[model samples]
Target: MATNDYTAILNELKGEITNMVVSSASAYADAAKHDAQALLSDMDANLQTWTQQLATGEISAQDLAFLVKTQKDLMKMQALKQAGLSAIAVDKLKNDVINVITSTIIGKI
Candidate 1:
């Protein structure tokens, strides 16, 4: 194949990859919004009493460890949610890249 042909194929692949990136970004945004809302709701439901205790300075030293653990769990969940969203985007990106390469090769042949 000519160099120009190769360049054209690459350009086409770039366009396809750009579209995939946009779609993945949109999906990630939607999922992140949903997950964040759920996280907020869960926190509200689970932590109101804890929050009140801390606010009132009534939390015993014994309970402090439990509160710390609960907070660590919350942080872990947030990280996992972000990782999940990133994985989804990455998967979409990989699939799009593969499809683009396959099509370019087959079409050239």
Candidate 2:
């Protein structure tokens, strides 16, 4: 079996995640800007720890999936809170975000 150099994978994943978050934030409304910025800041704080864990073999794809899910949930909730979106509308938007993130991350690996 060919051993994958997960350090490189993790690094690429991190960059992709950062890009996704930044682009999403850029599209936020003025009222939701603070929440989006906060989300990015939080992600930045954890990026180093996450990359280190993955590089050291302390985490796996499943862990990354969970992280991505949680991040998506938090981001959508924050946006909803700011936007006062209807439940149905929030669900639709959340699903879209989740799908995009999942596909982007998985496609990279």
Candidate 3:
């Protein structure tokens, strides 16, 4: 795989999130999918940069995860909130998304 390829990294990131959102049985699954994609898109630049760093050994998997978590502001789970999901559930989902990011990058590498 081309570690320098941002699009490839993005596609993998998106695929993981898409799978989670689509597999859910929630009534607001579509809205959740939209929200998730929006967050991912908003943070695409940072993700791409970090992915390259991980591939080049400039950052370890733990460092990548730390960076991903630092972007919690991007977790704006509007759909989940509107669907009455509690803060705990939303937080879990947020971490789930982060895990998706880190694991996907590691897998790609």
Positional deviation of residue 78's Cα in model 1 after best superposition, in angstroms: 3.3
How do the residues 1-109 of candidate 1 rate in per-residue lDDT, one tens digit apiece? 8999889888888887888888888888898888879877876765777767877889974686698688778779798879986987788789878888898889896
TM-score for each of the candidates: 0.66, 0.43, 0.37
Model 2, CA-based lDDT: 0.67
Candidate 1 backbone collisions, by pair: none
Q: By lDDT, is 1 or 2 better? A: 1
lDDT of 3 by residue, 13-68 (tens): 88888776555436355666777787778689889999999999999999999988
Q: Summarize candidate 2's per-residue lDDT along 47-102 as a digit string, tens digits.
A: 67777888898998689678878878887787767666435445655666677667
- Candidate 2's TM-score reads 0.43
Best by TM-score: 1
The list of candidate 3 runs beyond 4 A from truth reads 1-4, 22-85
Each prediction's whole-model lDDT (CA): 0.81, 0.67, 0.74
Which prediction has the highest lDDT against the true structure? 1
Clashing pairs in 2: none
